[model samples]
Target: MGWFLGLGIAGLVVLALSLVFDGVLEGVGGGLDGLLSLPVIAGFVSALGFTGALATGAAGAGAVLATLAGIAAGTLAGWATWSFSRALLRDGAPAPRGEDLTGTSGAVVTAIPAGGYGEVLLHLAGQPVKYAAKAAAPVARGAEVWVESVLSPTSVTVRPVER
Candidate 1:
């Protein structure tokens, strides 16, 4: 019982150290492909020690039986920790690009002369942004326009909206 408690305490100390020095041991396995991350090891050790103590103290199990139970619990804890960490590290949606502005609608901020450039207030990624605009025909300030194509990183070709 005394040894089991000591092991449990040691496991907790290792877990604390892992949190404080995160990524330090990430390359320890060299070729394991992140299977031996600090969090996974910490979870395994902590679960093993605590479960062993519980099995022995609460269930009155012998040392061998308690150890077996602890190993099973530790493996499960390690696998779950690995899965959760991988899920969090996975890539998310790609960022919005200037090309995505084509076909979107906006309002002309500066009156556009035919065959010239003006400014339009457009929404890119749901946020208002101003961009240089060109049209085949003159457009008045505050008139709604539809983007026809993106000409550059900061410019677009547009047509006045009918409605």
Candidate 2:
């Protein structure tokens, strides 16, 4: 009973530290898989063991049986929690669409000769993205431009801005 309690307390301390520190257990495993993780597994086993032992009056064989049962239950619960969290946090956001560039203002990164490809930088999702660009007329580097159309996933057609 004392051992189980001590183990549980230690495991909880480790778990708390791991939460505060990003790389507390990076070498232990590549990622946290809940109960499969060392700290989580230890915490589950100790918590369950102590509770089971206490409920069984801390007796001999009954205490052992209860501890084993607790470990099993904790493991299942931990696994379920981990899986649910992973699913809930899954990145379901779609990638930026090419059509999103239509009418957006940008600047030429490379000079675009008439009917030829160069490069233009546009702000999309708050970040600069360079795209292959072609202009109806020659556009020099640093010239202001606007996306006229999306030619492909990685290319676009632009027109020089009047200003």
State the lDDT of candidate 1 residue by residue for 15-53, as single tens digits: 788778768767787977567877788778778888889
Clashing pairs in 2: none
lDDT (10s digit) by residue, model 2, range 15-126: 6765666344546664544435544554565567556656566455465686776677667655665566567758798778889999999999999999899999998877
The Cα RMSD in angstroms, rounded to one decimal, for candidate 2 relative to the true structure is: 6.5
TM-score for all models, in order of appearance: 0.60, 0.54
Give model 2's TM-score versus the native structure.
0.54
Off by over 4 Å in 1: 1-24, 87-96, 106-145
**Model 2: lDDT to the true structure:** 0.75
